[model samples]
Target: MENEKTGEVLRVASDEERDQAIIDAGFIPGWIGEGGLRPEPLHDFEPDTWNWETGRALLEAAATSINPRVAERRNIRMANSAAEKRTSLNTIHCSYQMVAPGEFARAHRHTINAGRFILESKGAFTTLEGKKVFMEPNDIILTPNWLWHGLGNENLEAPAFWIDFLDDPLVAALKTIFFEVRDEDYKEMPIKEGSHHHIRWRDLDLQLEDLVPDPNGRYGKRLQLQTPSIPTMRLYIERFDKHMTVNPVKSTANHLFICAEGSGTTKVEDKTFNWQRGDVIAVPSWKLFNHRASINATLLEITDQPVIEALGWYRETTV
Candidate 1:
């Protein structure tokens, strides 16, 4: 065992008896073992994809078994395939949530910052900060940390679905998680017109009509969403032309992409993940990846790049 650790070590402490005494004193020999400090950032998440149809089917099935009134929220978390991480990434997390027709989840607030990308909606609304803001397909609605919000669907004909992204993992890791549920059912809220939290799809689509791909052929007609309130995360939309393949890039930030429309394949390292509308792909930190569209496509990219950059740990290499 002594010869097993053959790195540069100093002769400060000694003997088996002394080591045992140190252990008994509630301390380990610092000279032993390569510890938690790594040469670079390490993560359990890997390049993985989640099919929308599968998630929708599961959620649709859960509607009959998992009651929102009892379950509180009907969501399927996108746990990572690598290391069974039980999270989409180390710092970011995602879940596919559904609110059945005429069902509403009670109002709740938490210290974890969160937002959602609407996948299917009609007469679906979120009572955000005590006011109603209706959701539409492809819309992005933000619910920052500690902001009171509740979800519901007024449409009796169909259910509503959305992908919820959060900084819960980071919050939990920091041991600062705080949560509370409202007293009464979230109902009869006043309507909020042109709420700052709602980013309508109509506006974003109009902007993308004349947008151009990046000069370096990395990103498509990309749009960086203004989200100064959530300092831990950033949002973006990258549109790609039919059959267009973007250059591969590796970065220190975790990346999660939701296919807003069309079909495409994302190559992460040696693995290729094919995605279509409503599909999601998770590319863990420091993974080399790129996207190629089989048809004109739009992707919603969510990343913790803001926190990474803020900590002066941002790095990227494009090839």
Candidate 2:
């Protein structure tokens, strides 16, 4: 048989006895064939869009039964529907998190880098290094590896919600996952102002108002968030005018996009994902995708492009 990818050819074994002997010796001859090696990359996870309305209801239903004191967190992992996945993506994961009124999840730190994009918050705060960073809708709060952080919703009238994106899968594959919990109380943590860790929505929105699309017209009005501190992922916010459609491209970067405002539709290969405020869409590496705003909209994208680029494996092609 011909193996064009590796430029090798296979022939019938001239010595079955020797092959049997090799097997008996706990060895498989490399000349026979290869199972795991392939010519091109095969992204294992499926591209999927998770709706806020659907996830919100499920989280609401589970709120009463899910006790943060025992469960560690009350969040819904956005597990990919394909491959019977336990994570949202291969290298990264996203979860829908809810902090019920009057609930407090204790402070802890882990080797996994994580951040959250607030969807709704009347009164919710993340205690970062013993300081409370109040969460406002459309804000992004980062908790890098080994940063002691906890969450609480002291507002008695309503719960707080957010979408957390983490590089836990990458750490898991490297067998470097470590976590620890703090036994101390977080009730007395003081509020922090002008924290570099919090990216206020009001500020970003004001900035996006004056920006325009790429010179190549590949995307809508876009701004790349500075990220020297976070090496694994890249964050960007793109604003689209009503009924606008831009160029589609495929690249070797897995992406997760959260709808921060208005409504839109994203086309990923053969799939069409209709999204509204608070919805999230997951796109696997190398899939052609583009977006169109039914109304003026904003999308916050978190991607593993940095990791891919650091490995010198990043590539792209316009579709």
Candidate 3:
């Protein structure tokens, strides 16, 4: 056992006691462990919304002053206070990052796969593995594991911001994390000759209209937009019509839901949360939850289901 507040590891007398400690901490033990899954445990995270408007205000304040460590070579600016932590699950990390006009983040490579959901931006581009991809609102960009990547904002008057999602926690937990900073002398690297500029292109209006809900759907209707680039994570959009409701359901993997459009109410266990455009909510694993949309709602769903399923540990049960 470890004391989170004091950062001290607690020693237990026996392996059984250690297993019990982990169970008390709200997690199922690994396959090789003595402690197994509990049919029902208290959900670790409740449904809640993080307002983007509040986040943007914090971003503006952070822009007034910069941290020397982060601004030394990479002149990029970010709203540290606006970053969201995955309190529900430990596998994924999410944050709202901003880059000011004429600023650039220095190139770096790491073993963790990362992706960004473009929020609002113009004249911004991300270079990954020697290919430059221009970014726009609602677009998604991915940087494969261990690929060299960097971002720059060329817009003269406007700043670019996006929601970043990464599997850094999972990589760290497995003790397979690796990182390398690019040489300062080689800052302006050239793009690869045959690399494609964009990995994914989406039209939200057309996608919403085309994604019809099934009469016997389990969780309303969702359309997956992520390709098979990152094996450990999954991204998709769940669409709900006005007054529609998704019945309670539980899953083996935890979820991070971002309200892309419209308004809705999400109920997890006994708690309920209201959401609007650009709001984010974290849902823990095996939490019985339901949703009701006052108007048509589009929620960007990020999860680690793919990784759990690949390892034959994925489970789902409708309540």
Candidate 4:
């Protein structure tokens, strides 16, 4: 397996070697001892960014070379390889996905929850269970854990692309990863010609004006989108007005933020990075950070708070 972060190849000469490697990585038959210390540090202190330009170039190349090789799937993830994902302490996975015209991503269900933020699409839709959910630019779609879902691009002249986010790390840690593919393609039933009422994540439209200011006044105006389909996670859209700066606060859980619109500068402790639309930023657990927008900015924030909070291990403090 190719390790993206270190550019190293991990060779597995035999099944025994692979199983031993998996066990050495902190699991025994899919179970980790409750009090055993991890061999690896769970998180990275320095934040990193995945530039949109690089991602697009990779995706375009993948659409040609990689898309055809995999059956009903073509994706480039932001993490390392399958064995070592460095995206976050929680192992949140983000990827750029593409499906050529008339192509289909085979129907499958998994124990790990997932979501998609459609960046570009034309006549693209996903079938979750038996309902057809249309994809439009900026539309967010939910594919909850254990739900049978598949993707398709029906437009003849164009391909569709989107950002895929999943809580695979958490599932891997729990050793509860489960996946199954359907034997046949999921047929989309006909719907009212213009109705978009079946779009699950689109159920609530974002209205910035309707949001009350954050009580802490740390983050500027904010709107939290609850994806009931994936009840274990929460998503937020944070808005920063021109010249506005957010107060520093320690993160209670790992967060992956994508600049959906405008430009800004984020400071994680002493390190800072300038970000614009399409750039992704990862904030590992316990990092103190804040941001200032050069212009009005909007970010899509995904976090592992649901799992952390459930475990009663989440914490945060604002100065």
Model 3 per-residue lDDT tens digits across residues 107-197: 7888998787777778787877655667878777777688788777789799887777778778988999888876332245554422332
lDDT of each: 0.90, 0.89, 0.71, 0.74
- Note the clash tally of each candidate: 0, 0, 0, 0
TM-score of 2: 0.90
Give each model a TM-score: 0.90, 0.90, 0.77, 0.78
lDDT by residue for model 2 (1-319), tens: 3223334433333567557656776999666755567766788799998899998999999999999989999999999989779888898899999999888998899999999999889989998899999999999998988889999998998999999999998999999999999955666667899888899999999999899877786889999987566789899999999998988989999999999999989999999999999899999998999999999999999999999998999999996
> lDDT tens string, model 1, 227-305?
8878899999989989999899999999899999999999999999999999999999898999999999999999999
RMSD of 3: 8.3
* TM-score of candidate 4 to 2 decimals: 0.78
Query: Candidate 3 local accuracy as lDDT?
Result: 0.71
Worst 10 residues of 2 by lDDT: 1-10
Candidate 4 local lDDT, 190-256, one digit each (tens): 4323333233323333586566557776877787775666756778888888888888888568888
Better of 1 and 4 by lDDT: 1
lDDT of 3 at 240: 91
lDDT of 2: 0.89
Decoy 1 TM-score against native = 0.90
Error of 1 at 246 (Å): 1.0
